[model samples]
Target: MNTMTLWHITGWEFAALAFAALLVGFSKTAVSGANTVSLAIFAAVLPARASTGVLLPILIAGDLLAVATYRRHAHWPTLWRLFPAVAAGVVVGTVFLLWADDAVVRTSIGAILLLMAAVTVWRRRTADKEEEPESVTTRPGRLKARSYGVLGGFTTMVANAGGPVMSMYLLSAGFRKLGFLGTSAFFFLIVNVSKLPFSAGLGLIDGRSLLLDLALVAFVVPGALFGKWAVHRINQRLFEQLVIAATVVGGLQLLLP
Candidate 1:
């Protein structure tokens, strides 16, 4: 970090970051919110503030791969409904970042991840109780979308933690596997891309961070390919259980000293 070199970190740190990058791709293609692990890893490895910027481009790379793999199954109307609220949330997040210190950012992100994990678990448990799932077009559904969209945008801006929030929203809206993957692909791609200016303006996405990302991004390709190959064969229940467990551990790590 003092040297500002791409290889400034020790070998083990780089290995951890490389694995996290791979998870970013895998999460993009297979489990939607699973990258919460990657977010935690990146924040743990890099400075809390710099971690978000470093991870953004990597997430974008994964997003591109996801969109390419699941382009046809997206639900556009849902994405459209969430965008305006999400944009407002991003602005609010940006304003928050202007004053938040690294400790505050780290704590906020940790809390958000834990909260999102809880929400996901609750959604899953209650899923079978609903006789009819709400559509995004319903009056209640629009309110839900706005609420989740704002929260998603705020968290994504603050810590690249939007995935779980959006995942819950999509699940509550009743998306099946393919539609879920496709819609999320486009959603993150657009949202993350739009965040570039804000990150750069914040000095988070600097040349040094980009250099580190260059080394880490190569690992994402294979992870994404593996996800694409395994998506159909993977057991849905098992996959989500693992993701939630990992996310909980990550959140706890971030929260503790």
Candidate 2:
């Protein structure tokens, strides 16, 4: 791989980074679905392989802000139950990252996101008429955790595009408002940090990428602040619909040749 020089960052690249960072911040706070835009932008600006590494650090920065904002509302039991499964999924995803073809990864993630969106929409339409009762044990929750975890880890590791996948799962599980934000904040905080080793091992993070991350970090703060404000104003039904729509578009982009 060729090394990028610090001075090589063009005005347009900075613009792109700033915009992507804004989306990251917004996603952290307002609509988690917007991270798909961030993922697409970063991948376009940098090498697809290095984009995840470059964006991960910035994402962690944003995650810190999100946790600080919504820390009080987290559902510890839910997060705890999901941890082991998510961790397992991360390991599996990392292994695949080491060997999978880029095209295969992209298409698989796209298909998964689309399928998840379809399921989520179907469930939502049927939810009112016949609401499913919560399971007795954490088994059902764990299964959900595993399903979302594996898919989240895989899509995120490959393209930093797991936000919608996880969002759909959590929304379907019926977490409201801050609980949803808090849970997402914790989940991604762990997953993004865990991905660092795999990224470093792949030689994706380097001096130039770090410099870019530094520049982008500043944009996330305001974006997150905006997101925090937007959350309260959004209606639940509309939020779910928007999430589904974004997931569909993101998935189609990935699946496109």
Candidate 3:
């Protein structure tokens, strides 16, 4: 929009995007898994495919803040194992994006979220009954890393909505709050930055989207600051449950008529 109508968007649309941006910041530092809410909201307010482009920069901003706060705690071995698979997934996602229509994309994202939520629940329940060693059952083996990494990369590249996949993987690997946040923070910062060239090559990122990002980015700060405070005090079990519940809700919202 021109200077005369720089603020041309409707109030509700502005409000939705700002709210979504706020959620992006909070999810980055706190839950590390609830960002699908932000993704869903951004897609609801913008075009489904373009929303991924517009939100990427804002996510990177939050990623910087989170990594600064939790840099010391990242598990490098896990990152090393996952990166190659993640790159493979990104390439796959790029190919997929070339052919998928908006409806197909929306359906794919919703289906991924719902499927992930189901997998998380099943893993949780199985772990509860079997009671295997944390080392045996919870850590990311090569296979686990490859599986989750590929899915995380594909989901992120497709919708800017891979938080749950990575979150579920970390949680299964038995990362407590700080470790979870630190590793996820570092992972997304790298992965998201890596996606910039691909998104640009696809002509997904442009001046108008950047302009909208500029308008909404300021709202991320307060939410991120709040997340840092909340993470320190939140009950761990409750936090995990909240993340899963929110994931399910966000997935369903994307699929609803």
Candidate 2 lDDT, 173-233, residue by residue in tens: 8766676788789888888888888788877777877877887899999899998888889
User: How well does model 2 score by local distance difference test?
Assistant: 0.78
**lDDT values for all models:** 0.82, 0.78, 0.82
Query: lDDT per residue, candidate 1, 101-202, as tens digits?
Result: 877876876787788778878878876643332222222277888998998999899989888778767766666677778889999999999999999998
TM-scores for all predictions: 0.89, 0.90, 0.91
- Where model 2 places Cα greater than 4 Å from the true spot, the runs are 5-9, 129-140
User: Comparing 1 and 3 by TM-score, which wins?
Assistant: 3
Error of 1 at 65 (Å): 0.3
Better of 2 and 3 by lDDT: 3
lDDT, candidate 3, 1-257, per-residue tens? 12223245689989988988898889988977677888888777766777788899999989999998889878777788899999999999999999988788778877888898898888877775443332232456898899988988998898887888888787777766777788889999999999999998887787877888898999888889989999888876877787888778877877775
Query: In angstroms, what RMSD does candidate 3 have relative to the true structure?
Result: 3.1
lDDT of 1: 0.82
Report how far residue 36 has shifted in candidate 3, in Å. Answer: 1.0
